[model samples]
Target: MAAHFPINHHLRPLYRLLSALAGLYMLVFGVVGFVQTSGAEFFTRDEAEWVLGLRTNPAFSLLSLVAGVVVLGANLIGRNVAHHINQLAGVVLTVVGMFSLAVMQTEANVLAFSMVNVIVTFILAAVTGIASLYDRVGSLTAARAEEAHRHSARVA
Candidate 1:
């Protein structure tokens, strides 16, 4: 599976940019959500409260804020660290989204997550995961070798 993944991909910069944008969006959404729901209980399941078309509560807003900070911080650090962070974050987000979806209609929906929130979470997870796949850095020779190997594998 690792052999099939790209190394030093030409579009790495674009992927990084998209991931950074996603982080920014998350940060902004979290701040707005936090402010909007400040008066509500931390885990309130109120569907009336919304931020950027997504239901939110204090707990979810705080979690989002932390996630955004971690993602943006990793991007700033760059190198393999960012790659690892993106990969982990993607999986975590997917799991959280799934869990939220499961409890969405029940009293267990502490995050106040709606279907739209889950959708956005999944989208962000995909963006980060794709970025991770191509975010590796290596010497020119290594990259060339990897590309050649990939090309030959495709031809075979």
Candidate 2:
């Protein structure tokens, strides 16, 4: 009898959920951007002011929408693309979110607000990235093990 942690530790599901949440949040954000780009203001003026500030650059808005959709795709479709690729994509999403914040900081009026968003985005990205990477590693390892087992069986 050895004291050993379970193979599927507490972190695995945590990561999956985190990645899922990251994707879900991005999906919502993207939808909002898309809506705004189409001249739809779904938010109260106060709330919109609190977040988006005054300017509505259609190009930046479109970028936000596109990025959100891409991040969501990375989280959901990573596993399908090869485990390593999925993990890398998660990391990419995290970096992109943070990078977008820096880009926002360059704006004339919304420096502080954009920085705040940057912080939030970075946190989500890191959490989801770690989880996604962990999942990818586990999946790849399992796949390799299964492949090895199949090879042995074939040789027998």
Candidate 3:
């Protein structure tokens, strides 16, 4: 009585949806930044580049858009792929946010964003990243439990 191929436990669809939404937000944010500003400079935090008080530049916007696309695309591929994508994005964004905070007043950040903006990014990163990781671990544990149950039943 070996355990069946079907894995009963898995991450909820919400995690996948959240990841997709994050990506869409980045893509739209980039497009909106472009539309809102006339100067297509490679990098600037001028008032014109402000979207809801968060500064954005061509490079920043492009990067966000790319990240979003990657996340969304991963979700389309499969649950495992999506989980990995969220995990990767989480680590990157968390680091980026912390870096931004460290260099908030410095000129090192060409993609300088307001402190509030940076904080928001960190929150998003943490939420999606942690949730996906939790879901993945839970699913794995459930699968293992099911396998153990099946093994014990056959032994009995």
Q: Which candidate wins on lDDT?
A: 1
Report the lDDT tens digits of candidate 1 across residue range 35-147: 88888888888543888888888888888888998888888777777888889989998898899889889988889888999999999999898889988778889888888
Q: In terms of TM-score, which candidate is stronger, 1 or 3?
A: 1
lDDT of each: 0.84, 0.50, 0.70
User: In angstroms, how far off is 41's CA in candidate 2?
Assistant: 15
Report the lDDT tens digits of candidate 2 across residue range 11-104: 5556666666766665565555555645534322222322233233334345546655665566566443323433554576567556665565
Clashes of each: 0, 0, 0
Q: Which ten residues in a row have the lowest lDDT in candidate 3?
A: 1-10
Q: How well does candidate 3 match the true structure in TM-score terms?
A: 0.76
- Among the numbered candidates, top TM-score falls to 1
**Per-residue error at 155 for model 1, in Å?**
12
Model 3, 24-123: lDDT tens digits are: 7776887777666646677775543777456887777777778777877876664567767787889999998998888878887778677876987897
Q: RMSD of candidate 1 to the true fold?
A: 2.2
TM-scores for all candidates? Answer: 0.89, 0.53, 0.76
Task: Flag regions of model 2 displaced more than 4 Å.
Answer: 1-11, 37-57, 77-86, 93-113, 137-156
Clashing pairs in 2: none
Q: Model 2, residue 133: what's the lDDT? A: 46
